[model samples]
Target: MVMLFESSTIKNITIKNRVMMAPMCMFSVEKEDGIVTPFHLTHYESRALGQVGLIMVEATSVTADGRISPLDLGIWSDEQIEGLHTLTSRIHAHGSTAAIQLGHAGRKAKTNQPAYAPSAVAFSEDEAIPTEMNEEKVTETIDAFKAAALRAKESGFDIIEIHGAHGYLINQFLSPLANTRTDRYGGTREGRYQFLRETITAIQSVFEGPLFVRISAEEYHKDGNTMDDFIYFAKEMKKQGVDLIDVSTGGLVQAPIDVFPGYQVPHAETIKKAAQIKTSAVGLITSGRQAEEILKNQRADFICVGRALLNDPYWPKRAAEELGYVIEAPKPYARGWA
Candidate 1:
């Protein structure tokens, strides 16, 4: 049976193990220029040195106004390439493949700049109603995703994960609750998914490496997208050359979601079985035994360790020991681990 320590490969890239670092926003850019800082280099390298299989960088903006916050990283311009390239080189040097989550926060964007969305709606009462995106604007955003993909390739990322989850721009378009447009980009499920399809097509044009899409499978609202809806999306993503579906939930609306260990694992398992695509289970997955069971049961191809990894960069190394798997630690750390 596949275990957490066993390596997994997607397309041409091989991951050292099943422990993937989920993309979490850092909001650490001191200059607000969207360029990565030395903090990012150190933060990611620590995970790589800790033996995480794949280190996915935080949600990086594809456009100036697409950032979730002014402090988020940006890839809309070529100037940011140097920092990202440096990051990828460090990750590779330490035996981990680097990946990045390209995203546009859309109406959820908290920057001072005006936000854009499929519909002219506000994420909440305090937030401003965003300008509805016309065809021209939509095309511009898609082009941005394409440009960002090329930048990711140039930066040497082994995988490009489209951040379509967490109530971001793509999720805003996908969720009926946030999108009430009557145009071609809304109304029906296919219409709601059109933006993502176009974005994927655009990215695939330049990126030949493994592609992944993270989606909020359960919107937590009665009228929002459901498991079946996500399965359909997973199938569509497969047709669009998506190598994996990063399964996450409950970012479409501000509803209370009960938290528990492995709450989102079933969503990943369901999508993997129905959509016939590889998947990564995320959320509250904190231990090696839990991750191993999920893989052994064929629920997911990878286990995304989020907050646990943040809390302890060496979480994976500790997990390996707990599972009785002797994962090779870095030479200097080997004596301490021994």
Candidate 2:
């Protein structure tokens, strides 16, 4: 039997299989207003129809200033609710659970507006230096996350993922390289992770479903956070009601990383074992056999397929065929599977 085709439960939600469409930013909002367009509907629905177990929407900003790009989607205002609701409805129609990744770009936001971070640091020398976050700003961001979670719940999403990776705002705070704050929100591990811990708590207040946190497990620099740091971070996340850790490495700062197939699998394995929490492994996981091997060896629970799905919307369907698991195709496309 193919374990990759097996159903897995995260909290109260049961996904149809272990194949997940990893969240990839689609900078196609058209007007830079952060509203969902027809492009988003077609893009995401195709993956659900492809038989992906979980379809995680890309990083959506909680506030206008938090957007990674002006064209990125937003869950900030009430106006975005209807379109998001329609999106979830369509994904659910195809038998795949829909999820959204809520995030803030902070110092990395590629907008004309001023950015905010744990300290006044620039992602690079050429980028704008971000303003250090004050207590009021921290509270506002937390409230924004809370409000976004509520909006996600209203939009009928089955899960909510906190984007704490890829050198974004949350990652910026957790990283000592980016965050040089002298307040309670910086310095020690507990201090560095305070923002994420509180954000999770705030999200739980409004959304009571499967919650996943994506983290950059390795910063790549010798002085940057290592696997041991992530293990401890994952443990703190578990304590705050996080159900899964979406493991990816690098992007905390620019450094050379040895990239190869399944390079991030060991990081996921270490966090899973040390933190005793479920993890989703991502990073160059392009084939079904590779995904199956990861599960077979108990490295991770979910295989997050990113660029592979973008290259082939029916990648999951192909994976099912390769694994010899008869996954149900959409009624109109059923004959193709036959």
Candidate 3:
């Protein structure tokens, strides 16, 4: 049997397959109000119809000013719940589990509003210097994440992933390269981890469903968090009741990286073994056989396809054919698919 096509359970949810459509931001919001648009509905539902097991929505901001871009989706307000509910319902109708990634851009935010970060640092020379988050700001942001998780539950999502990767607010806090402070929120590795630790604790208070945290295991710099640091973080997450770690690398700061088809798989494997937790391998994993090899060898529990799925909404069907395992298609495409 092809392991990629096999079912797996997380919490009380049974995902039909190991193939998950990795959350890639569309930045397609018609208005700056951060509401879901028709394009989003069509974009995500296509993958669901194509037999992908999990369709993770893009990075959704928890606050208006926390957005990476004005066009990013928002769960900061109750009004946005209706549109997201419709989206989750559409995905479910086609037998796909829906997940949303909650994120805050921090210093990387490009909006007109001033960005906020753990330290008053600029992402680059060209980027604006962000305001250092004070005690009140930190508490407010943590509360924002907790509130967003509740909103996700109200929207009918099956899972929630905290976007702690890609050099965002959480990453800034977790990485010593970006965070430099003497307070409890920075300095040592444990101090740097305090923000994410609190954020996870906050989200868990309200969200009981399967929770996942995506992290950049390798920061690609000498001073960045090492593999040992990542393993410690993963173990801590497991103790905190996180169900999975979606392992990806880089994006903490500007640094050269070697890119390859399965470059990020090794990190996932290391984290899984070191932490004794489930992990999803992402980054350029483009074929069924490759993904199957990883799963068969127990390198990673799930495969997250990003650009490959964007290139072809029916990438899973093509993968099934490559592995000589047929997956049932949506009824409308039955004639062509068969």
Candidate 4:
């Protein structure tokens, strides 16, 4: 166990370190067409060169209706694949593995126009209420995921992470509180798990690399989903060839969370224990010691930092130095190390 410093493998891919840069939306893309502009390339390349082991690209929607923002990257068609390929190639040149986060906004879809969801519910005070998804739309959504995985492979990504966390369409379906359908998609726990299970199986057909699913370990509502749901989902996902469970919490409804240092680590612990699968702990993880403890305790397989890396893109190199690794500063910065 002390050899936790050793490299880790998931399927065909290997992460040099367990440190990953969490996917966070920059909402910086000026185009509504979801093109990978200079801003996207620069932002990701900076982290790769700065020494992050693996950087999951910000949530890229599988369809226009799946996007969190109009400017978010989309893989709905063949045209979008080239731009992502460019970005992935750039990350590889910098010696970091590139991962694409595929998502669907679901009920969270639409901001200005007609929104959609598993049920007619408003997620936030300002957001519009969304329409429930019919069976036809659900089948299309699964195909969209499969297509997105294909695009991720075309773009040369080392891994593809399905965005099932944060009250997105997939998570909305996972939670009985949000998913009220009586058809094949809702009702019993297995029924609620169907969407994710099918989505994973569909995507697996296209992506042979390491597959990841970011899930809300706890929906944070008495009536909503819980850790047990995610644990069950994790085991099923593993059986379906999912490589890791990116552990996260809440986002079913817009409510303030009582956050503290390493607040969601326990969520990862519970899921890891129950599912006995590789898990990635995210949210409020800051220091090296805290990250190290998570690894040592078998609480998580990966420690993902989003805003923390944004604040200091060089944090990985600094973290390595602090954690007793011989970190090599950039050639330009090496003189300062003297």
Candidate 5:
């Protein structure tokens, strides 16, 4: 079997293929209530029907003020569970495992409410200077993640991925460039990792299913996290029993980055080897052959397709064609797919 189409297991969940639909925020939530709308249902279900093995729902905020935008999906309230449950049910019905990305946008939040972060810094001049979180707020935010994980379990998600990358709440605490606190939560590298470590521990307390953490392995700034820093973080995650590391780069106070196909694969490979952990490679990986090469070489265990899937919900079928691999289609599309 082609490595890309090969089945893999994490915890007790088996994914039919290595293709994971990366979480991309729809910014389509109506009424500003943070609930999943019909648009989300159709949007995600179409990818499931297209035979993607793991459908990772977008960066859903754990609190109302933590949203990247007012329209982002949320898991902060129990009332939002029903819509997410329906979404997961639909994805599972189409033979795909459903996962949700639990996140808080931190200083990147674009809502009217004041944003919170590890320090009172602005992501950019265009963005507002966020409030520096105190010990009370820190504990509260960690509890929010734990609460969100419970909601994820209730929502019928098979996997829960903490959104620790992309200069968001967790990333702010992880990146020295973003986190400049003198308290226990900042200062040294170990201190910087404290927030994520606690967050992971908190979620694990309530969540026993497969847990994944996405990280920006390569922050473009000179003073940002080095590969060594990333490797240390990965090792800590491995010790914590994190099932996978979805590796992506940049987005922490972005500097100039040279974009290329599979540019980020090496980081994933390095982390997988150094940390002795499974990882998912993402970023500009737009073709089946490219994905196959990554898996065949054991660079990463899974491939996360983002914008490409947006362009084609049937991206897996297109990939199968490119790889000359005959992937089984949904019954109704069998004739056309064949």
Candidate 6:
């Protein structure tokens, strides 16, 4: 059995249990874009009460231009900060550590305004081509990440996760296939990583919470992004003070994935062993016994749960019960746990 009581830590934040909530997009918020809608509070509070060790809020755009979808939550302005405070406080009240994934969609952005990337590439599925960014726009994006990190800190989250994986902006930069720029942000491997490196560095200037970057360890396309890329990216991030990597894969271009139980655990294992950084494993991890084995074998430091929990909100508590570990339920639900 995975030791249910085993605590997990990343930099300055400690989680009371091994299970973490993988960020799932709600895209449910008030029309103001930055403000929290009622749906977000209840959706997250239930997970908090369910006793997950840490809860990562869905990715919030670093700026309006960065939004993955128009309906996504954000903290680009002061107005967005207050509602997030309520979110953090509620998560804390349930004894769960709160985390948020800050992101920019890059060419993937589908908001009403024009989308942008290193080149004017359109996703195969989309009709509109993304506007390739100019030098000034790139610089401004970096600043936006920095300012967003500062605002997230002000919102009282215990940890900060950069959205580097799943074919987002940073992932675009990481892949040789998508980025063919001739500027400082392109060409060689070091050049490809320049955008992500700069983004993390700029965010570091304003925030010091546990820094976690979500990464797609493998790109499904063998030549597109190499495991060698992951090795290099992981080491560089650690050197730049990245505390943990939330390891997941295959969001490049929305293609179908061939997956099995714990298919992505190898990515976590590879990074933990090679880069010497803490890592969290996601993708089809559903049960306590499976999760425990991964931790015991040193495959992953933390277990990130997604869809399974959506199926059963008390998945953690039930897993503990099944594994012969005693865990307390919230008072309102204590009798059932007992």
lDDT of each: 0.93, 0.92, 0.95, 0.83, 0.95, 0.87
TM-score for each prediction?
0.98, 0.98, 0.99, 0.95, 0.99, 0.96
Q: Model 2, range 1-338, lDDT digits (tens) per residue? A: 89899999878999999988999999999888889999999999999988888999999999999999999999999999999999999999989999999999988888768899999988887787889999999999999999999999999999999999999999998989998888889999879999998999999999999999999998878777767778889999988889999999888777788889999999898899899999999989988899999999999999999999999999987887778778777899978778
Relative to the unseen true structure, what is the C-alpha lDDT of residue 290 in candidate 2, on a scale of 0 to 100? 93
- The sequence of per-residue lDDT tens digits that candidate 3 reaches over residues 36-120 is 9999999998899989999999999999999999999999999999999999999999999999999999999878898999999
Score candidate 1 by TM-score against the native: 0.98
Model 2 TM-score (2 dp): 0.98
Superior by lDDT: candidate 2 or candidate 5? 5
Q: Output the better candidate (3/4) by lDDT.
A: 3
Looking at model 2, which ten-residue stretch has the lowest summed lDDT?
A: 220-229
lDDT of 2: 0.92
Residues 1-338 of candidate 1 have per-residue lDDT tens digits of 33898888889999989999999999999899989899999999999999999999999999989889999999999999999999999999999999999999999888888899999988878778899999999999999999999999999999999999989899999989999988888988899999999999999999999999999999888889877788888999999899999999987678899999999999999999999999999989999899999999999999999999999999997898788878887999878988
- The per-candidate count of clashes, in order, stands at 0, 0, 0, 2, 0, 1
lDDT of 6 at 226: 80
lDDT of 3: 0.95
**Residue-level error in angstroms, candidate 2, position 84:** 0.4
Those runs of model 6 whose alpha carbons end farther than 4 Å from true positions after fitting are: none
